[model samples]
Target chain A: MGIEPGRLQFSWISSAESTKFVEVVTQVTNAIRALGPNPDFTKKLAEVA
Target chain B: MLSYAEKIREIAGRLLASGAVNMVIGFRQGTIPMMNEPHFAKNPAEAAKLVWDSHCGINLANYLTDRKEKIGIVAKGCDSRNIVTHIIENKIKREQLVVIGVPCQGMVDKRKIALKCPGEITAVIETETQVTATGNGFSQSFDKKDVLQHNCSLCIHRNPVIHDELVAAPVEEQKGIDRYADVRAVEAMSPEQRWKYFEDLLSPCVRCYACRNACPLCYCPTCFVDESRPQWVGKGQDPSDVRTFHFLRAYHCAGRCTDCGSCERSCPVGINMRVFTKKLEKDCLDLFGWEAGLSLDVRPPLDVYRPSDPNDFIK
Candidate 1:
């Protein structure tokens, strides 16, 4: 398997870096994954697709 | 002009002198004539090879995830937007990075420019910092517009989005145009026509996912399509299976894609991938009045929802 390419491999990768947006994105992506697509709602998508 | 080369060298020298960064990610001449490839330089000698010019068009920001240690990178407008998306998504930390901002009006669509300016030319120059290209030969100079890529005309930023150091005074701002004019035409169609168009595009998909890998926003640790434990998509080539992967990606990235043209550029099977992304980009702009990744302060639309979020089908 090819190596997993990181977001900025061509640049410095740092763990100590603090993101001003981390709290917001965590709240966001978690909210998204938590709300699994509604089966009934997706059923409509199924029809549309 | 061709000043990016010397500027990169000068910046690399300063970084080396200060021990500010240990490596520099920039472009080096490629084996192919007039082609460039990403390069990593650890020392001043190697850094001296860094180059940024018309041919240095590849976006280097995609390489930044999980990489530890301080390093500097060269980034253009679209590439910088991608960096912002990664930072906001927590995929890459924003610190420990030194972005060498290079003012790029636009880069030549190599293949197209080559087709236009066949054989050696005396000089090829950017006519406008980010809007025009002009090439000169023995006795003739023609507007670079003749060979500029479609993306260039619609480019809103000809300058880098983030940078520790500025290379060449930043170019004047360029107005963003509705580059997805063609996508709007498809949307103007009735919902039935829109579905038909999408189905047609999805049906031809081989599900190779060259589109996903090429996308700047697609930086997930594990793509949903690749999940086998719960099995989102079995490794099948059925038309229906292919459509599932395609639409899911578009829907996931509905309000997030910047339409940098990389997904379509990276597709090998000749799928018109742009149509779907552009349609979604336009819808995000129209419905939510939002575009993705430009501002780190604004959460991606899908990731944040208002209690009053509009849903026409909600009961």
Candidate 2:
């Protein structure tokens, strides 16, 4: 439940609204790029492996 | 005005004697004060041992999981709600149960009382109005309304939603209660402050799964903590492991927890684990306008998805 908000995104777009969907995806991609990878999950994954 | 103990025994005994049910799940007097054991009455004679009081905080629905026997179970508002959850989840059948509902006032917080009176609590006596805690050298009494479990005080449903028979007329449901004040207080904090708040809050955990074991909703055949294949949670006293366990446990109960307060009650170190579950409960209510175990017909929020369901935070 402590999942960082930046790591996840949700938006509603109809099939007709392809441009809106692309815009949302681009915004999310840029935001996540700025934030970088989720260290907590990556560290946990490494420990598990 | 409710004489629950006598009524429960009478109803349970009748159910057993009539051969309507093979077992009656209820509470027996506990070995110590402020604790009651979840018990199974196999015969009319054993049904005589069934009692109800402020101490019967353990959810008896935990015993109903995968039980094949026709059961007559004593259920408070929260317990009845959990039974509905169980029925919806296919943990048990509605036809297999005869719910003996009790209109709850509230269960007392023994820890609060213990803090008020500093000694071994030898005996605790409760009435509708007050609770008296007695020890060797001291006797303290407090208003019943003042010491109820946080969940119980703000409970919207004080009457069983589904029951075959009631021990008494349904108690008035609590109205206009601010159920999420503590949650709101935490929400007001900065993200870093909140992270620190929870870390400090869970610092006392010894990784004992008493909270998980006590919850009726947590009847997973193999809990994630026990999974060895790509083990999800470490079974150590490390603070991160403890936090992970708490986080996942609360998440698992997202749409199904009835805010019964058993998890908090069962904790040895008195951690308020309800903080985690209540946040989920509030979110479900806000997002879906749903409360757990209110009806058998409706699926839990996470169990079913609609095309129109909100996804505003998603890309």
Candidate 3:
């Protein structure tokens, strides 16, 4: 629940709005990059003994 | 509060006697003090067993989901709101319901009252403004205001929002109450701190799903936690799974949770899950100017699209 707001983004884009789609994609990617690797929700793989 | 029980019984009896409703859902005295269980009265005789008190905290609307017969339910403010939600959600039709509304003062918190007495509570007596709990050798009286459920204390909707008949005159609603102070406090915390806070809050969770069971909104035939084909959450006591369960459960009620406190009241470990739902409620209020279950004429904000709706969170 404490996940950053930018982790998930929602936008409505028409098929014709190619530029808007690109801009939103770039914004989302940047936001994810800024948050860095998410160690919280990811399940850890069991180590071989 | 006791007087309301007589009127409730009379109304339930009349409803059953007149054949206006096939069943009247209300509360009966539980085996223990301050714990009332939901009762279904199919005839006038059963209706006489219906009682009203400060402990009728379990939401009656939970039992109304997809019910077929005509039902006359005893509804307090939150219960009526949830009934409205049930109708809007198409879980039940409004035409099949005859809501008997109660002007709720507030339901007392049993946990709070229990904290005052050193021994087991054998009996609890309630007056209009005071609660007296008696045990083997001790009796303590608490001011009603001091022991009200957290949600009830902050409730502005003391009167039923919708009803076919009123049990008593609507009590004056609480005015100018700061309902979101705790939510706002959580929102002020940094992400890491908030995560730590929730981790501590949910650590005691045993995955019993009592909260989900008690919630009227959680009528999903197969909740995400139970789906094994593509399991959304693990069944064990993993912290992430617990968080996911709580988060997803809260998200499912985004614009629909009435803060009835049934989820909190039903929790065996007494985890206050209202903070999770209350945050979304505050968001709904702030972003969409909406409250859940207030009207039948209008749809919930999340269920409809309007150009005027806020989209600032979008890229």
Candidate 4:
């Protein structure tokens, strides 16, 4: 319940605003990257290797 | 509280005798103290079995979903709210229900009383302002205010929002109560600390779906937890799975929960899961100026979209 807001983002972009959509995507990715990995609610998948 | 039972029985009997409704849904005295069972009265004879007391904490609206018969339901404040939600959602038609509204004081927290008593409680007696618990070796009386269910104590709506008949004059509603103090306390904590607090709070969960079953809002035919084709969550009691289940369920109730405390009351392990829903309730009030199910004419905030709606979270 305490997950950072950046982890889930919602945006509205028209087809005409492709550049704005790209810019917003970059902003969201960077915000999530800064928070790093969440320690809770993430399943530890088995390694393929 | 004692006279309420007599009045409820009288109203239910009249409804049944008049053929106003096919069934009258109310509470009957439970075998054990502090537990009341939902009773369905089809005839006047069965209506006579109906009772009302502090232990009638379960919401009567939970039984009304998609029901086709004309039902006369005993509704307290929270139950009436849920019934309103049900009508708005098209789960049932408003014409099919005859709501007999009850002016509720509050329901007692049995778990709280159980903790205070030294022995098993054999009987519980309630008056206008006091509750007495008698048992094998202990007899204790408590001020009703001290033992009220946490949600009930902070409840703002003690009178039904809508009804066809009144059991008694509407009780004065609670006012100027800080309903979201606990939610604010959780918000004040750091993310890690908040996570730890919830993890500890939910650790005792055993994956039982009692909370979902008790909720009037959770009328989904196939809840996320039960969907196997996509498998939204695991069936076992894994910590992460448990968190996902609780969080997702809380999300499902976002704009619709009445804080009736049925989920907490039905929990076998006594987990206060209202922590999750109450936060969303506060947010709905703060962001959308919405308190759920107070009106039949207005739609819920999340159910409709407007250009002026808040979009600060969106990039």
lDDT of each: 0.68, 0.89, 0.94, 0.93
Using lDDT, rank the candidates from best to worst. Answer: 3, 4, 2, 1
Q: Note the DockQ of each predicted structure.
A: 0.02, 0.20, 0.58, 0.65
Backbone clash tally (model 2): 5
Model 1: TM-score, first chain: 0.34
Worst 10 contiguous positions by lDDT, candidate 1 chain B: B131-140
- For model 1, the superposed segments whose C-alpha errors exceed 4 Å read A1-49, B113-142, B190-207, B234-236, B307-315
Off by over 4 Å in 2: A1-3, A9-33, A36-49, B312-315
Task: Using DockQ as the measure, name the better of candidate 2 and candidate 4.
Answer: 4
Error of 4 at B265 (Å): 0.7
lDDT for residue B200 in candidate 1, whole number 0-100: 73
- Candidate 3 wrong stretches, greater than 4 Å: A9-31, A46-48, B312-315
On TM-score, the candidate that comes out on top is: 4
Specify the CAPRI tier of model 4: medium
* Collision pairs in model 2: A9-B314, A10-B313, A10-B314, A10-B315, A11-B314
Relative to the unseen true structure, what is the C-alpha lDDT of residue B52 in candidate 3, on a scale of 0 to 100?
94
